[model samples]
Target: MSAIGGPCDRALWYGFRWASPKRFDAATLKRFADGHQTEAVAIARLKACDQLEVYDLSPDTGRQFGFEDHHGHFRGHMDGVILGLLQAPKTWHVLEIKAVSDAKFRELEKAVEKVGEKLALREWSETYYAQAVLYMDYADLDRHYCVVCTPGCRRWMAVRTERDKPEAGRLRGRAQTIIASDSPPPRISEAPDYYQCRWCDHAPVCHQGEQALSHCRTCLHSTPVEGGEWHCARWARKISVEEQREGCPAHLYIPGLVPGEQVDAGPDWVEYRLPDGSVWRDGGAAYTIGDTIEAEAYRHAA
Candidate 1:
């Protein structure tokens, strides 16, 4: 099985339990990393502006602000906070920076122009709106300044937003539901060939159900500590929430973890017969075994 990352794995925004868990292929991961690098440059330029006093919160070891829910299960990290801007003076605002493609930037710009910033953000990008609201609520700020930029362009757009208590509360409830449940939430569709599922990184495991015991928190070897800490018996050490969420290569599912009849068993692998007559394989790296069927079929036809 693929290694899990950290507590952020189970974040509501990542849509792991609600949608499918994100599995980043090399190209996708590279693109994500490149976006962050570009955003870093943009932030540096923003900091250089004498009119603004930017407080950087992205650093791992710094004066960063975060929030943990009552159970300490949900966590969020703010990007930064800004003190002054030409539009909003003498007021502190949560700073959210996003680097989008030229096309996406144009879309956002047009939406803002046509329907206004608040309505356009809700209609165009619910994710961004939710993120901004969550940060605003956690940082105890009423106003937010979102900075959107393009990769190769110095031009940027700034949109201001107010605190959205209702939306933030809804998101908090959704996060709690994900953390409390053992079974995953229902898929967006029942069909395997659904468009979103086809492109999802977690498609392979999501469709397989219990066969993919990849989450460390779900593994029997992991035990919860007092403050949402996870201890892995296999590793014999306390693992951070992120480490627990991102399971290790040595992960092993507890016996009878999957609720199905065992059809075949081997030293390192077991196949179970599901109610739908589909076979679910549980073992080391077995989750990826049948993932290349389409590619193989294409090769044979060619």
Candidate 2:
């Protein structure tokens, strides 16, 4: 659900397929840590508010309020459930906390003041707004409240969004469709310099980087099945997470993911002619592919 709201369909597909391992640097790691601490501070402050009751954890299960679909393959977790806001004391609002830069905070305030919370929220960040709606639908709530703060917790603002069942339903269908797809979806941009693609993690393979981590999720034989399970047709069994990470000798890459054009194929192998005039083969085959350094390196490492 967190990724469902992203701009690129292909990026989301790549993520679901485990096309790339997510790697974050030290600065990014620190920022994530700081964000969590800020959320905690903000939650504590919210708890101090006399006008609202914050259920940070689900009273029903004594855990975070979480919901899922497609047999738990698609899931979402809320920041909390908010009750007793003075604006609508009887209504329950799904709570979402966000930490943004000070500049962004000011811009958000202006947008909210100009067009109101719901519209401002949709414009502020489609990702967050999309997530909020799904959260509302799963939680069986109609309203969502957002508490926005700065990194240092020096400034605060709130925005509220109403549930759109039709929109949420569409998003849910989108998620299910992507989850069931045997191949990746279309790219959002063709250019490497496109703003959304610039910092994307999948850029390497998506744009020409040859190496993709070998895993069941990236293999041709694996398919996402009903009941939140992954099945490997090659082995004729359910694939555990460990098995997915450590693919077998019979593993084959999804042809589309490779940079070359498919020139020959058979039950055992699919061959390609890479741009450098070298042949590459994914599985055991009689035809020889010359100089598959990348493939050799990956398979060797795997």
Question: Candidate 2 residues 174-213, lDDT tens each?
Answer: 8988898887788898999998888899998898665688
- Model 1 residue runs over 4 Å out of place are 1-26, 58-61, 208-210, 213-215, 220-225, 231-273, 276-302
Instruction: Please give the lDDT score for candidate 2.
Output: 0.85
Q: How many backbone clashes does candidate 1 have?
A: 7
| TM-scores for all predictions | 0.69, 0.90
Question: TM-score of the candidate numbered 1?
Answer: 0.69
**Model 2 residue 1 lDDT?**
95
16 Cα displacement, candidate 2 (Å): 0.7
Query: What Cα-based lDDT does every candidate model obtain?
Result: 0.65, 0.85
Tens-place lDDT digits, model 1, residues 83-163? 878777888998877878788888898989898975776555677777778888887899888788886436688788889
**Clash tally, candidates in order:** 7, 0
Residue 279's lDDT in candidate 2: 96
